[model samples]
Target: GAGVSQSPRYKVAKRGQDVALRCDPISGHVSLFWYQQALGQGPEFLTYFQNEAQLDKSGLPSDRFFAERPEGSVSTLKIQRTQQEDSAVYLCAVQRGFGYTFGSGTRLTVV
Candidate 1:
């Protein structure tokens, strides 16, 4: 991928349903990050992975949220038993030093 790409750009889920969002990071990027952005708020780091290793996942709000970068390139974020509070944009970024490229995001709406 030339830059980070996220699929569906938008999603709507019923409460208690599960949803999965996808991200394709820049080719060969070693660092990938997932963030959650609520409306009018800055992105908060949800997890980070270096290559295929998940170095940190402390920011995930709950056990219902999970992320992985199996091949160290593309990643997926899955939310189980979605709640109304889960309605927000899920952002993906690939780190290149202090610079990171961000995807437009998948807006998940749990109604």
Candidate 2:
């Protein structure tokens, strides 16, 4: 894709269910980022990947949160045992040329 792309723009999940959010960065982009935006708050960095290696994951809230980009193009963020606090917009972005390409994001709501 010419720009970043994400699937399942909206999602509703049971309290204990697990969800996987996907993102596809623009072609040839080498940097990727995952951010979580809670309602009424700014997006917070969740993880960052430079090519296949995950450069940083300290921003991930907990062990239940996992992100990966094995092939360095498409990435996925998985959350286990969804909780109300996990409800937010998951944003994916790719960095290049001193700027970023961002996806529309996936909205997740856990009941």
lDDT of each: 0.92, 0.93
- Model 1 has an lDDT value of 0.92
* Cα lDDT of model 2 by residue, 1-108, tens digit: 348999889999999999999998757789999999999999999999999899999999999999989998999999999999999999999999898878999999
TM-score of 1: 0.95
How many clashes in each candidate? 0, 0
RMSD of each: 1.4, 1.3
| Regions of candidate 1 where Cα sits further than 4 Å from its true position | none
- Scanning candidate 1 in windows of ten residues, the lowest lDDT window is 1-10
